[model samples]
Target: MGNSSSSLKVCTDHQGGINWLSLSPDGQWLLTGSEDGTARLWSTADSQCRGHFQGHESYITFCHLENEAAFTCSADHTIRKWDVMTGQCLAVYRGHTSIVNRILVSKDYLFSGSYDRTARCWSVDKEKPIQEFRGHRNCVLTLALYSSQDLLQDSEEEESEEEKLSKDFLVTGSTDCTVKVWWVSSGRCHQTLLGHTGAILCLILDAPNRELFSGSTDYTIRTWNIVTGEQLRVFKEHQGSIICLELVNRRLYSGSTDRTVKCWLADTGERVRTFKTHKHSVSALKYHAGILFTGSGDACARAFNTKTGILQRVFRGHKLVINCIQIHNELLYTASHDGTLRIWDIRPLCKRGKRRLKKERSLQGRSSQKGSLSRLFNNKVGCVVHQEDGREQETVELM
Candidate 1:
């Protein structure tokens, strides 16, 4: 791998592998859930640990960060909310009978999917679940939220009675090879999408487009019409299980155990480009300012040009797989199974490369899109109910 170790900053405090990572909306803080049975908050400005949240009896599986609080789910079958500054445990959401796989926070509610084979919605102010989604036949591996407000914003025409009465929806993907859409207001199963033949691994929603993209162990990515329960498209180029998916500007990017990343046109299902530089499974993906950043089981993160399909830089140093990645303010944050969060100064290196690419494109008479590569300096799960013998088995869970 190409070396860029001189610009890297490592935060080594977690005792076990970091499973998940979340960035505060303001881009000032980062929250990481770890196999150490705790979650910690760090400052993005200085790479300093700001708060340490400890209370779970088992390893944390996932985490989400908000303005005032940090939420973490664990193998202990509980979800805890912590104050961002004080690190005090505020509330414990206890109801799942098995491991909680993922959590999503929207407006005033929290949604969780678990190995318990159900997804539940909770009021942020309450301790118990306000609604239980109980239809999945296997572990609920991933969760996503779509607000009806987005539909309202997308349409200027008069709303129908159904549209007027529609509440926000919660989408869950499971090991049962199914995707369920539930009404957040009534806890009713709005739609059950069936197509995949293997476990669903990751999900991403294009709310404005009313489309849902799901990556699966079946080695395919499928698109669905969330409102009509219709299968729209299937992208089946990956040679191994599809692990992660990212959508920006109607372009879809997927990483797989095939040790490659592929880009596709979301509307047309056309494969645009392939990035095959990774030596192991591509575990995570993040896109910022026209650059695609990928983390892999090879313990390295890399940056690639979206338009030209060029490998720009490779970040190496981690001793284990990188679990998740986040980019903000020209700094790249990578969480890994090495039990460390490493931040890289991506500013100096990428700026010069981006300028050169822009000049080349201009000379070729090529125009950039609204959020294309020419704009630089931009700052920006799994199922199964099987029980293990000794310690809980570690799996890849990303958000």
Candidate 2:
């Protein structure tokens, strides 16, 4: 209903909407996959469109940036590796029976989920899949890594384990209404969590709390024990599909097709607050530095206070829906249906208005309780600063 205070700076305009965004671990550049059948790299500092890697014949659904290299999955049913600095397609890995919807990487291996209803594990360098994991009955919509605890527990049971348990396992959610955890190394299914009556839209692992949270088209959010495959709780407040769930510290933030952002107790299924921040369906959500960033089909990325649920700043830079948002260091990056990516100076916003408001109010009190509002708000209170002077010593809260 009101104009957004923060301004948007466009970084690049591709031929199609950017679907997913990833930042290089060093934070030097950004990698994005789009429906244009390509992945592009942009310089973080200058906002320059550096290079584009093109090979996929269809929409690129996801991409992951690692150092100077990147990996992408596409609706074309293939995964391609690229040299980020040059934008050259270095290698192509093809084996999926349908569109590759997601791609994930560990230290040495790559994992992918597809519309073909199978998840595959591949060797990153050789571009060869070592094993195919088949269990889900429908499209694998989302994939997430599990906790070290689950991985260790699964390994202890095998008399002779072929899978070298990485520090984490993997969770794959599908349209068949099930979430499955797999042994990363052995490509074996560990647990299958079922309850949702509709398609699973998102799957997230809160390793610190040892729990998994999922959003679904069934208009519910479900929590489960990652190790035991036990259904912990179900939150049925949203009237529409819960498209995205953000876990900051312990607080659970969910964006929904109902055009609202709901805050909940991460560990328990208790509702804390509900606030409307978008004109239409909230397609994506991200919370960082005391700010909740949400992108909507209304063609804007809006920021709100994590604790107060008050509007902080609205960034309107795209002409179409924003699909995903990721924050790195001082910059906020967004991928949009307008076929472009943009970056903003988060320090300016986080250090000035709403950020200062958060520190002054102490809105988030201290608590170790999992999913408490305190952990959600206080975790992003910005970096504290202490200054010394000759006349008098004083402390200034910059953010």
Candidate 3:
């Protein structure tokens, strides 16, 4: 299939590389954090920069949006909340003695993980830590939250059981090459999942399916049963390190230093397709519905078909490699390596129709013998091609 990089449009410009991006849960705004020590809020419809907050002293690593307020974690060793409408600093939660790598938010609590080998849970409203979870031996790279429903079903019920028992759980992946699941309320360790040979970069839970996926620097993606702590499968084919992963439907999507994104069947562990979207290492990926968005060291953000493995669009405006991308509603937010966060009005671009593949001419030579024809019988050869509309194009060639 012919590649079409020009079909994509650039919506905005950010001089620095982005670090992290998130869309407001209400679907009204977008937020981004960057190495420039700033985070910005943008209007979803027009991609207008509504406001920018510049209180962090170092590179901002992560951002989470809750209601109308946004929270950010930075190498400056601080976490700050900002007003989405006016970009005003609402509160700063600071206590970590080292650079913070990641952050997670629930309805009532904010969790921050750092290189100091600790994770702290804070009150979202009061903006203070209520509990400190300390045990890991290295930098915490990622954290995932499990719903209360998961805990309720996992525990054995008692005769005098409390119906509305408080339940909260968090999973953290670290450079220590382990994934730890913890009880947030009691600050207790639930389970430690050990498998990867290198540092774990990302961990995600498909709570609906009771599956956990982890991407690591060991060049593999490992799937595990969250309840049983059993290793389900390991996908290992990349030539370099695997950095990020996202799952949609029953397929698993992963990005690697091999400069490619590969799709795999979650149930069979079979490789479905592979696409080279960036020239450098892919750092992050986000998938919503059927569209896949990726950020990489190539200084670009790209959109590709999740099924057919076709590169549909290439967004080039960041001065350095993009670190993160998140789409909420119709707006796309990208964080880059240079230090700035950029927002785009992607509603128009997101409405792309299905891709059409060029039909291939079939060979017309016929078999001489009836027995030969029966032995060499071939059905229509069809290949699934990627189109911009987030659907596959089946090109069938008759022989």
Candidate 4:
């Protein structure tokens, strides 16, 4: 691979790999959680560590950043709230019996999904949970919130009954192969979406379109009408489980265990383009200003053209798989299993490059993934087969 290291800066304060990343509302700072059992704050401008909060006994898994405070979940079966200005542990919220996988913060409520097969909603200032949503037969893997405030903020359309049905609704995706929608205020189950054959890994909402898009281990992406609670369409293109979803400019993008990124028409669910370039399973993705950012278990992050799905520039720093990615305004942030966060000045790479790069997709099919996080992390050695000659080759250890 060509050297593009000079265009980016890496933060190396975390002793273990980073699991989650979030940006402040003002886009001035970044909050990241790591396997080191700590969450650190980084100044976006300088790409330097400003502060760290340590308390969790196990790996930190998820993070949600708001204006004054940041919330992080952990494998320690607890969630800690930290002051954004001081990096101090303000309060700790505990209820889940298993690892907390994801968190969502709305106006006055904090929601968490866990391996305990339930989702809980907690008050921001209180230590105890206000409500617990229980029904899934397996672990909850992801969480998302859709509020009436979101629909009113951007679109010029007038308010409708569907928009006023509930002030806020919480969506939880689980390993039970189902998604549950609940009203936050009353804790009433609004709808139960069931179709996926495998676990739901990631989800994203389209407020303008009033739709919910879910990616799953079933190798399918499904779109549903939020108001009607009906499955509108399904996009089936990825040969492996989808782990990440990005929506931009009325287009939906997905990163899959198949080591590729696929783009689709948000309205029609038609596949637009598939960028097959990663060397291992893709773990994260972000689309901003016509550029696509992807992170993979191959221990590399790459930038791709949204229109043509062509490779642009490669970012090499992480020694392991990248876990999450975020873009605040002009800056690009990536968290990795290498215990580092990287900020890349993408302005230079956004321009035309000297060589027109073609995507590198191997003919060897990806192995089926099972269990939560197994596709992104494995301690045991793996094997790779050469497609051209039927020869078994030992896979290089990336973690």
Candidate 5:
């Protein structure tokens, strides 16, 4: 297959490298956090800068949008909730003594994981934190949340509010090389999963199987039974630290500093295949609309066919490491350490083969003669009879 080239129609405004991004539920807007210590809202329809929230003193580490408000955590040691429509800081949660690296929002609680070796639970209705989970010896690196419906979906009876609140759990990965599952209602450590030789970097839940998958700096990914706190399997093929993990349609896709993304059979933890394209660490990944997209330190984001393990598209433009990616409404939003947020339209590739061919042919018609070295691929080859010097020169032929 010939390589397909495409360009984006919009590049949102940001001054510093984007650290994180979140898309609105309706796909009409996007929120991005940057090293510039500010977060901005952009209109996806026209790529206009709609609003800017600027009060943080340091890098904006993460951002999440919930309902009509948006929350952002920062190296400034605070998480601020902003009204999406008005660009006003509604409330500031300032309990973390160190940088808040991540945030998780539930129905009523907002959880913040920090470098202070603690995870604090906040009432979304109030500014003060309700409970503090402190157990890991090192800083918490990531947070994941799951419910009874996620772990015990086969139960026929509807769960009571008491049972639902009791069973709701918060999963945290820490630099202490352990995974802790905490009951949200009690703030008690339900289970402490240990076995990693290095720091835990990321984690995800296998909802249907009641399993938890964690990746660590130790270069191995472990699968655990959340209920029993038992180690189910360990995938040790990655040569470097695992950076990101994504689950789609029962398949586990992991990105690693080893410069590859691997798929696993979530149920059995069996390796399905590995796809390599990035020349540097695969720092971020998102699986959406049947395509698995990955971003890396190599300054590229790629879309791969998850089933066939084929690289279908490559997104380029960043000058530094790509920190994150989000896909919404067939649009791929990428955050780069190069200090920009790029919006790529994947619709060109989503069309049928005939339509793709038509576009390719049109691009070919306009792109021919723009470059000097690709005559072989750009035009048909032909022979010309020698006249004066008995030497045939290059001639174009119609296909």
Candidate 6:
């Protein structure tokens, strides 16, 4: 694969490092939070700054974008809602005594996790917090929400009166190495998941399957049944800290500080393949169609084929580590600690032609051989024979 920086567009107006990026639901606008204490809105079509949101007293830690509004949380110990088109601050939410790390907006309720070791639920129209979840002993790093309807339906057993009356469930993961499930209606923690020996860095919810996956500095990914808070499975192949995770079609993709990205069969906890092209820790991951896009500490973003574990393209130009990535309208957007947001057209790289077709056929042939051998030879010690490039090869193996 070759570097594709020539076709990249750079947006370098931010004076400080970008900490987070959020793409709007329609994919027409992008919002970025930075160390400069401001969040700006940009047009993805032309890479132009459409609105500049100001007024945060400290650097922004995270941001979320909606249809007509933007939400940003900062070290200023507050979260602010802004009108996306006009760039006007609509409301300021203040309650956290420390830095606000993440914000999630669901319906009319806004949920925020902070360094205060608390996650709070706030009314969108009101500036005050409606409920506070105060069990985590360390900074809250990630947040996810499960709808009330889904939670009720997924329970194999009858729900309690309190659970039936709950609005929704808010999930929080923290530096304390725990994941807490809270009822949004009562501000009470329903369950505390404890298994990771290190800080929880990221979380992704597989709601349809009633599962929650958490990645941690413990170098493992753990799955839990959200309904019962029962530990389901653990994926422990990574040699370093797990930084990010993406779930697509029951397949779990995890990026790690081991400088590799792994693909797993989500339901079975089976390791499918590994992509080892990254030169440094894989910090961010995004899955679109059949391609896996990654941002790494090497200051480069790469595209890989999920099926064959082949590197398709390399994006280089960022001067520092890439912090986040988003894909929209055939373009890939990357925000970096280098104080710039870069966008690249990924349409050309996504096309499958003669070369890719040939590779797929070769991979299929090898896969068939492996499947046949696995079914026929049940012995722990055996000689495995396979054909590659028209040559026969034999290898001795131990189970």
TM per candidate: 0.86, 0.85, 0.80, 0.82, 0.83, 0.87
lDDT string for model 3 (185-278, tens) is 7677778898999899888788877888998988898998887778999998888888888887677889999999998888878887887848
Cα lDDT for residue 29, candidate 5: 81
**What is the per-residue lDDT of model 2 for residues 281-372, given as tens digits with 9 covering 90 to 100?**
99988877677889999988888876567787788768899998888776788889888787776776677644566555452222113234
Give the range where candidate 5 is weakest over 10 consecutive residues by summed lDDT: 390-399
Over the full model, what C-alpha lDDT does candidate 5 score relative to the true structure?
0.82
Arrange candidates by TM-score, descending. Answer: 6, 1, 2, 5, 4, 3
TM-score of 1: 0.86
Candidate 2: C-alpha RMSD after superposition? 8.5
The per-model lDDT (C-alpha) reads: 0.87, 0.80, 0.75, 0.80, 0.82, 0.89
Residue 4 in model 4: lDDT: 54
Per-residue alpha-carbon lDDT of candidate 5 for residues 1-399, written as tens digits (9 for 90 to 100): 224445475454678889988887777788899999999998878767888999899999999976488899999999999999999998899889999999988877899999999999998878878889989898998999988656755655564566555757889999999999987777878789989999999998877678899999999999998767889999888899999999876678889989999998776777888989789999998876556788999998888766577888888777899898887767778888777787788875555333544554565554444333344434455533234112111111110
Q: Please give the range of 10 consecutive residues that has the lowest summed lDDT in model 3.
A: 390-399
Q: Indicate the TM-score of model 6.
A: 0.87
lDDT of 1: 0.87
- Report RMSD (Å) for each prediction in the order shown: 12.7, 8.5, 8.6, 15.0, 14.0, 6.7
Q: Which pairs of residues have clashing backbones in candidate 4?
A: none
lDDT of candidate 5 at residue 365, scale 0 to 100: 55
Mark the regions of model 3 whose C-alpha exceeds 4 Å error after superposition: 1-16, 151-166, 328-332, 339-399
Q: Would you give me the overall lDDT of model 4?
A: 0.80
- Best candidate (score: TM-score): 6
